[model samples]
Target: MKKQIENRSDLQLLVRTFYAKIRADQEIGFFFNETITDWEEHLEKLTDFWDMNVFGTKNYHGNPIIAHNAVDKQFDQQITSNIFGIWLNHWFATIDELFEGENAEILKRRAQKMSTFLFMNIFESRGKV
Candidate 1:
Protein backbone atom coordinates (compact mmCIF):
# COMPACT_ATOMS: atom_id res chain seq x y z
CA MET A 1 0.00 0.00 0.00
CA LYS A 2 1.10 3.57 -0.61
CA LYS A 3 1.99 5.76 2.29
CA GLN A 4 -0.46 8.40 3.40
CA ILE A 5 0.40 12.03 2.92
CA GLU A 6 1.70 13.03 6.32
CA ASN A 7 3.64 16.25 6.08
CA ARG A 8 4.47 19.43 4.23
CA SER A 9 6.89 17.51 2.07
CA ASP A 10 4.12 15.22 0.90
CA LEU A 11 1.87 18.16 0.16
CA GLN A 12 4.65 19.73 -1.87
CA LEU A 13 5.15 16.52 -3.77
CA LEU A 14 1.43 16.21 -4.47
CA VAL A 15 1.12 19.75 -5.77
CA ARG A 16 4.20 19.32 -7.97
CA THR A 17 2.85 16.12 -9.42
CA PHE A 18 -0.55 17.63 -10.12
CA TYR A 19 1.01 20.61 -11.84
CA ALA A 20 3.22 18.40 -13.94
CA LYS A 21 0.16 16.62 -15.23
CA ILE A 22 -1.75 19.85 -15.77
CA ARG A 23 1.07 21.61 -17.57
CA ALA A 24 1.02 18.90 -20.18
CA ASP A 25 -2.72 18.45 -20.49
CA GLN A 26 -4.32 19.31 -23.80
CA GLU A 27 -7.57 20.83 -22.57
CA ILE A 28 -6.42 23.41 -20.04
CA GLY A 29 -2.67 23.53 -20.32
CA PHE A 30 -2.67 26.74 -22.29
CA PHE A 31 -3.74 28.78 -19.32
CA PHE A 32 -0.90 27.51 -17.14
CA ASN A 33 1.66 27.40 -19.92
CA GLU A 34 1.01 30.93 -21.07
CA THR A 35 0.50 32.55 -17.69
CA ILE A 36 3.04 30.91 -15.42
CA THR A 37 6.45 32.28 -16.21
CA ASP A 38 7.90 30.92 -12.97
CA TRP A 39 6.96 27.33 -12.37
CA GLU A 40 9.01 27.08 -9.15
CA GLU A 41 7.34 30.09 -7.58
CA HIS A 42 3.89 29.00 -8.70
CA LEU A 43 4.48 25.51 -7.38
CA GLU A 44 5.63 26.96 -4.07
CA LYS A 45 2.52 29.06 -3.85
CA LEU A 46 0.36 26.02 -4.65
CA THR A 47 2.17 24.01 -2.00
CA ASP A 48 1.37 26.72 0.47
CA PHE A 49 -2.25 26.75 -0.63
CA TRP A 50 -2.55 22.98 -0.27
CA ASP A 51 -0.76 23.12 3.07
CA MET A 52 -3.22 25.67 4.32
CA ASN A 53 -6.17 23.53 3.23
CA VAL A 54 -4.80 20.11 4.19
CA PHE A 55 -2.89 20.97 7.37
CA GLY A 56 -4.59 24.14 8.62
CA THR A 57 -1.49 26.18 7.93
CA LYS A 58 -1.91 29.91 7.28
CA ASN A 59 0.74 30.29 4.63
CA TYR A 60 -1.59 30.96 1.71
CA HIS A 61 -3.48 34.25 1.37
CA GLY A 62 -4.12 34.86 -2.28
CA ASN A 63 -7.55 35.18 -3.86
CA PRO A 64 -7.97 32.30 -6.29
CA ILE A 65 -11.12 33.72 -7.83
CA ILE A 66 -9.53 37.03 -8.66
CA ALA A 67 -6.42 35.40 -9.99
CA HIS A 68 -8.36 33.00 -12.17
CA ASN A 69 -10.67 35.73 -13.33
CA ALA A 70 -7.69 37.73 -14.45
CA VAL A 71 -6.34 34.74 -16.29
CA ASP A 72 -9.66 34.19 -17.99
CA LYS A 73 -9.63 37.74 -19.24
CA GLN A 74 -6.03 37.52 -20.31
CA PHE A 75 -6.65 34.39 -22.31
CA ASP A 76 -10.06 35.48 -23.56
CA GLN A 77 -11.58 32.20 -22.46
CA GLN A 78 -14.22 31.49 -19.92
CA ILE A 79 -13.24 29.15 -17.12
CA THR A 80 -15.84 26.43 -17.31
CA SER A 81 -16.81 23.37 -15.34
CA ASN A 82 -15.17 21.18 -17.93
CA ILE A 83 -11.85 22.80 -17.19
CA PHE A 84 -12.32 22.40 -13.46
CA GLY A 85 -13.30 18.79 -13.98
CA ILE A 86 -10.04 18.16 -15.79
CA TRP A 87 -8.12 19.79 -12.99
CA LEU A 88 -9.95 17.85 -10.32
CA ASN A 89 -9.34 14.63 -12.17
CA HIS A 90 -5.61 15.24 -12.21
CA TRP A 91 -5.61 16.27 -8.56
CA PHE A 92 -7.47 13.21 -7.35
CA ALA A 93 -5.46 10.94 -9.58
CA THR A 94 -2.22 12.31 -8.13
CA ILE A 95 -3.45 11.90 -4.56
CA ASP A 96 -4.64 8.36 -5.18
CA GLU A 97 -1.39 7.39 -6.87
CA LEU A 98 0.77 8.71 -4.05
CA PHE A 99 -1.16 8.06 -0.87
CA GLU A 100 -4.13 6.34 0.78
CA GLY A 101 -5.63 7.28 4.14
CA GLU A 102 -7.53 9.99 5.91
CA ASN A 103 -5.37 12.75 4.52
CA ALA A 104 -5.81 11.54 0.97
CA GLU A 105 -9.54 11.21 1.38
CA ILE A 106 -9.81 14.64 2.94
CA LEU A 107 -7.71 16.17 0.21
CA LYS A 108 -9.98 14.74 -2.47
CA ARG A 109 -13.04 16.06 -0.71
CA ARG A 110 -11.50 19.45 -0.15
CA ALA A 111 -10.33 19.65 -3.73
CA GLN A 112 -13.82 18.79 -4.97
CA LYS A 113 -15.39 21.46 -2.83
CA MET A 114 -12.75 23.98 -3.76
CA SER A 115 -13.21 23.22 -7.44
CA THR A 116 -16.95 23.67 -7.15
CA PHE A 117 -16.56 26.97 -5.36
CA LEU A 118 -13.99 28.22 -7.84
CA PHE A 119 -16.11 27.14 -10.79
CA MET A 120 -19.10 28.95 -9.37
CA ASN A 121 -17.07 32.08 -8.98
CA ILE A 122 -15.65 31.76 -12.45
CA PHE A 123 -19.02 30.99 -13.98
CA GLU A 124 -20.64 33.93 -12.25
CA SER A 125 -18.03 36.24 -13.69
CA ARG A 126 -18.78 35.12 -17.20
CA GLY A 127 -21.16 38.01 -17.72
CA LYS A 128 -18.20 40.33 -17.93
CA VAL A 129 -16.82 38.54 -20.92
Candidate 2:
Protein backbone atom coordinates (compact mmCIF):
# COMPACT_ATOMS: atom_id res chain seq x y z
CA MET A 1 0.00 0.00 0.00
CA LYS A 2 1.15 3.52 -0.72
CA LYS A 3 1.41 6.30 1.86
CA GLN A 4 1.47 10.03 2.28
CA ILE A 5 4.50 12.23 1.72
CA GLU A 6 5.24 13.35 5.24
CA ASN A 7 8.91 14.17 5.36
CA ARG A 8 12.02 15.19 3.44
CA SER A 9 12.87 11.52 2.91
CA ASP A 10 9.59 10.99 1.11
CA LEU A 11 10.25 14.09 -0.99
CA GLN A 12 13.66 12.71 -1.79
CA LEU A 13 12.10 9.52 -3.09
CA LEU A 14 9.56 11.38 -5.17
CA VAL A 15 12.12 13.81 -6.59
CA ARG A 16 14.57 11.06 -7.43
CA THR A 17 11.97 8.74 -8.89
CA PHE A 18 10.08 11.47 -10.70
CA TYR A 19 13.25 12.87 -12.29
CA ALA A 20 14.35 9.40 -13.31
CA LYS A 21 11.29 9.33 -15.53
CA ILE A 22 12.06 12.84 -16.75
CA ARG A 23 15.59 11.83 -17.62
CA ALA A 24 14.31 8.84 -19.56
CA ASP A 25 11.44 10.48 -21.41
CA GLN A 26 12.14 10.67 -25.11
CA GLU A 27 10.23 13.84 -25.88
CA ILE A 28 11.58 16.03 -23.07
CA GLY A 29 14.52 14.03 -21.79
CA PHE A 30 17.14 16.08 -23.54
CA PHE A 31 16.03 19.23 -21.78
CA PHE A 32 17.19 17.77 -18.49
CA ASN A 33 19.77 15.22 -19.49
CA GLU A 34 21.77 17.79 -21.37
CA THR A 35 21.69 20.45 -18.68
CA ILE A 36 21.90 18.60 -15.42
CA THR A 37 25.33 17.01 -15.24
CA ASP A 38 25.33 16.43 -11.49
CA TRP A 39 22.48 14.06 -10.77
CA GLU A 40 23.21 13.68 -7.07
CA GLU A 41 23.45 17.40 -6.39
CA HIS A 42 20.46 18.32 -8.52
CA LEU A 43 18.27 15.67 -6.95
CA GLU A 44 19.22 16.76 -3.46
CA LYS A 45 18.33 20.35 -4.26
CA LEU A 46 15.02 19.31 -5.78
CA THR A 47 14.25 17.14 -2.79
CA ASP A 48 14.85 20.12 -0.57
CA PHE A 49 12.64 22.26 -2.81
CA TRP A 50 9.78 19.80 -2.61
CA ASP A 51 10.32 19.28 1.09
CA MET A 52 10.04 22.99 1.69
CA ASN A 53 7.06 23.25 -0.62
CA VAL A 54 5.06 20.39 0.88
CA PHE A 55 6.10 20.50 4.51
CA GLY A 56 7.09 24.14 5.19
CA THR A 57 10.72 23.18 5.65
CA LYS A 58 13.07 26.15 5.70
CA ASN A 59 16.11 24.54 4.18
CA TYR A 60 15.49 25.11 0.50
CA HIS A 61 16.78 28.44 -0.77
CA GLY A 62 17.14 28.12 -4.49
CA ASN A 63 15.14 30.23 -6.92
CA PRO A 64 13.40 28.08 -9.50
CA ILE A 65 12.22 30.95 -11.67
CA ILE A 66 15.74 32.18 -12.26
CA ALA A 67 17.06 28.69 -12.77
CA HIS A 68 14.39 27.76 -15.29
CA ASN A 69 14.77 31.07 -17.05
CA ALA A 70 18.43 30.36 -17.48
CA VAL A 71 17.67 26.97 -18.95
CA ASP A 72 15.22 28.44 -21.41
CA LYS A 73 17.86 30.90 -22.53
CA GLN A 74 20.37 28.08 -22.78
CA PHE A 75 18.06 26.29 -25.18
CA ASP A 76 17.49 29.43 -27.21
CA GLN A 77 13.97 29.88 -25.84
CA GLN A 78 12.67 26.75 -27.55
CA ILE A 79 10.79 25.51 -24.53
CA THR A 80 7.11 25.07 -25.14
CA SER A 81 3.96 24.20 -23.26
CA ASN A 82 4.24 20.60 -24.42
CA ILE A 83 7.43 20.19 -22.45
CA PHE A 84 5.80 21.47 -19.28
CA GLY A 85 2.82 19.20 -19.81
CA ILE A 86 5.02 16.14 -20.10
CA TRP A 87 6.92 17.16 -17.01
CA LEU A 88 3.69 17.55 -15.08
CA ASN A 89 2.48 14.16 -16.25
CA HIS A 90 5.59 12.47 -14.97
CA TRP A 91 5.31 14.26 -11.65
CA PHE A 92 1.66 13.31 -11.17
CA ALA A 93 2.31 9.73 -12.21
CA THR A 94 5.23 9.35 -9.85
CA ILE A 95 3.28 10.73 -6.92
CA ASP A 96 0.37 8.42 -7.64
CA GLU A 97 2.69 5.45 -7.82
CA LEU A 98 4.37 6.14 -4.48
CA PHE A 99 1.92 8.13 -2.39
CA GLU A 100 -1.73 8.73 -1.67
CA GLY A 101 -2.96 11.44 0.64
CA GLU A 102 -3.52 15.16 1.09
CA ASN A 103 0.14 15.97 0.76
CA ALA A 104 0.38 14.10 -2.50
CA GLU A 105 -2.59 15.97 -3.87
CA ILE A 106 -1.18 19.22 -2.61
CA LEU A 107 2.10 18.48 -4.29
CA LYS A 108 0.32 17.87 -7.58
CA ARG A 109 -1.62 21.06 -7.31
CA ARG A 110 1.46 22.99 -6.35
CA ALA A 111 3.45 21.59 -9.23
CA GLN A 112 0.76 22.50 -11.69
CA LYS A 113 0.64 26.02 -10.36
CA MET A 114 4.39 26.30 -10.27
CA SER A 115 4.69 25.09 -13.84
CA THR A 116 2.31 27.73 -15.06
CA PHE A 117 4.07 30.36 -13.06
CA LEU A 118 7.48 29.32 -14.27
CA PHE A 119 6.39 29.06 -17.87
CA MET A 120 4.82 32.45 -17.79
CA ASN A 121 7.93 33.94 -16.26
CA ILE A 122 10.05 32.26 -18.85
CA PHE A 123 7.88 33.58 -21.61
CA GLU A 124 8.02 37.01 -20.10
CA SER A 125 11.77 36.86 -19.75
CA ARG A 126 12.14 36.20 -23.44
CA GLY A 127 10.62 39.56 -24.24
CA LYS A 128 13.17 41.38 -22.14
CA VAL A 129 16.17 40.15 -24.05
Using TM-score, give the best candidate's number.
Answer: 2
lDDT of 2 by residue, 2-89 (tens): 9988888888899989998999999999989999999999999888888888878788898999999999999999889889999999
TM-score of each: 0.94, 0.96
What would you estimate as the lDDT of candidate 1? Answer: 0.89
**Sliding window of 10 residues with minimal summed lDDT for model 2:** 50-59
Cα lDDT tens digits for candidate 1, 14-125:
9999999999999999889999999999999999998988889998989998998788778766577888899999998999899999999999998899888887777677
Those runs of model 2 whose alpha carbons end farther than 4 Å from true positions after fitting are none
Residue pair clashes in candidate 2 = none
Weakest 10 consecutive residues, lDDT, candidate 1? 120-129
Task: Give all candidates' CA lDDT scores.
Answer: 0.89, 0.92
Error of 2 at 114 (Å): 0.4
